[model samples]
Target chain A: MNIQLIAEIMGTVAFAISGAMLAIERKMDLFGIVFLGIVTAAGGGFIRDMTLGIVPPAMFSSPMVLPLAILSSLAVCALVAWLYKGSDEELHGERFQWILNFTDAIGLGLFTVAGANTAIDSGYGDYHAFVIFLGMLTGVGGGMFRDVLAGIMPAVLRKHVYACASLVGAICYLGLLCAMPRGYAMFTGAMIVVVIRLLASHYKWNIPRVM
Target chain B: MNIQLIAEIMGTVAFAISGAMLAIERKMDLFGIVFLGIVTAAGGGFIRDMTLGIVPPAMFSSPMVLPLAILSSLAVCALVAWLYKGSDEELHGERFQWILNFTDAIGLGLFTVAGANTAIDSGYGDYHAFVIFLGMLTGVGGGMFRDVLAGIMPAVLRKHVYACASLVGAICYLGLLCAMPRGYAMFTGAMIVVVIRLLASHYKWNIPRVM
Candidate 1:
């Protein structure tokens, strides 16, 4: 399988798991958890497609992605249920949070590069702001929606360098795309995001609070 | 010149004002207020167009709307700034809330019909669920985004009969379109939302919360 395809599926699953876990934390029902998971997995691409004017977004175009998202969500739910054995308190501990953060950073990096490549492929590469916006949104939009649904401030706006990491990855992807093979640029760009995001969280870095 | 055009502009302005007020309440900067205002003014249509596969969205097509949204937000900011003379407390009275609610209801009703009509014009009239979904999202999406940005739960999910009222209006528009003239249907549908929303607020009608 192509790296792009693998990244897409992996990112979708990772993001879906993160979303489902947050929904569980929120005490949402099964349907809500599943719904939140699907939206979080797909919402960024949906927003990016809308911005780029791609009708019926790729989420709707390919039947595989939606089912994959659902399956991933179900798997996550089942695993978490078994691990916690229906104990909500156990699920809320620090260990699960570290896993969530690790997976989320990976998803952010993968989705950022994927989104940047899509925008470039769609003839938006020349517009740096547009490409960056699409890439950043594709990385962070789903999580923002998840946070909103959970009634919390979006981490992208307040948390440690999350959106900034995506922005850096997108910029790197676009910059390297002009000089290197697509695969190399994609790999390097995604890794940059993952590394920076991990470092930022570990160091407790955050954008300064204005208010 | 037409009622739809009038409604679109009016609703945009009303929504912008509501968003601006919320931004002020949150003590956001001028940039945040304007950003929230523009998103609230145009976010719904953006979502609807994406669903229908309209690339680039109507927001880009008409340069007029973006500027108009900005202008309205500025006007609102200026008015509130002047009214409060830079004191946040002065803007927090009960009267302002009543006015906010009054304008918000009108915007919701107008946006619901406009969204439904757009869906119908796009050949989604036959699919009642599609029309209803488009219409309701167009009405509620902006406010939801605004609330999320302000770190609060969306009113549609928590407030009295808000989404339900929009749903009623959207259903009414679709039903009436099957038998009546477009103008009549639009007017009736919008009025139905406005009246019901007003009555619901006055009567303290709320969807019951289970947990």
Candidate 2:
């Protein structure tokens, strides 16, 4: 499989699990759980595709992605069901945040590079902000949707260095592309985001709230 | 000016005002008010455009729409500021709901036609679901964005028969187009949505909560 495709699959799986976990935390119905999980898995790419004017999106154009989204959602939903099957107290627990953060960070890293490269491949190489925005959206857009649907402000708006990490990763990828081959540059960019995000979470680094 | 243009303008104004009002209710900062207002005015079209593969969107493509969005947002923000200047008690009052519902209904009517027409023009005429989905999204998508950003459940999910009204209007428009002129069909369709939405609100026709 292509390296880009590999990154995309990894990102999708990680993001889908994170979303499913959030749905469980919210105590949403089965429909809500499934819906939110699918949305979170696909929403970022949808946003990026839409912003780039790629109509029908990859989810509709290429059949594989949507099924992957559904399958991953099902897998995550199953995991959550099993995890909380015996106890109601664990339902509202914060114990899962560490695992969620880890998976989310992995997704953020891989997606940032994928989104930035996709933009560059689409002939938007000259537009710095466009590439960065697409990259950031691909990294965080699904989580934003999940949060919004759960009736909470998106973490991107106030959370610890989420968008910042994506921005940096995208910029790093774009810069590295000028000096290195695509594969190496992609790996470096993904690492940058993963490391930054993980460190930020561990250190509790946060963007100051405006309000 | 064209009838479609007139409808678009009216919808923009109504949506912008509705967004501004919601921002005020949330006690968001001035920037949030402006951001939410602009998003509400153009967000639906943005979604429609993206789904249909219209890149850069009309907001950036035509130039005129973005300014119109900004101007409408500013105008609405000013009106809200003026209205609530005297007291904070009335700020949280239910008095604004009437005006908000009226404007939202008008927007839904116009945007549904605009979205449906755009989809048909894009060669989606045979796909009934596509046309209806686009039409409904164009009508409610902006408000959904507004509500989500404000961290609330989307009104279409549980509120009055808003989605029903838009769906009926889109189907009506599509059916009418087979026999009538575009102008007549469009007018009739918009009226159907507006009337149905108004009636739904008046009668409190709500979709029951599943969860």
Report the CA-based lDDT of candidate 2 relative to the real structure: 0.80
Query: C-alpha displacement of A108 in model 2, angstroms?
Result: 0.8
lDDT of 1 by residue, B1-211 (tens): 4777777888888888888777777776666677678888888888888788765566656555677888977888788776777455656788778777787788788899999888988987789899899999999988898887777788887787999999999999888988998888988998999899889989998667799
Q: What DockQ results for candidate 1?
A: 0.16
Per-prediction interface RMSD in Å: 5.3, 5.5
Model 2's chain A TM-score stands at 0.92
User: How does residue A134 of candidate 1 score in lDDT?
Assistant: 78
Instruction: Give the clashing pairs for model 2.
Output: none
lDDT for each residue of candidate 2 in B1-211, tens digit (9 for 90 to 100) = 4776777777888888888878888889888988887898888989898789776776677656667767877876787778778788876667788777787888888999989888888886766666876898899899889988988778765564767788899999989989998889989999999899888877876443222
True contacts kept of each: 0.26, 0.23
Kindly report which residue stretches of model 1 are placed more than 4 angstroms away from their true locations once superposed. A1-117, A123-133, A142-152, A159-211, B1-3, B178-180, B206-211
Q: What tens digits encode model 1's per-residue C-alpha lDDT throughout A1-211?
A: 4877777888898888888888887888899889888988998888787778777898999776799878877888898888898576877799888877887888888899989778878975665656776788899988888887877777775665777789899999889988998889988999999899889888986443222
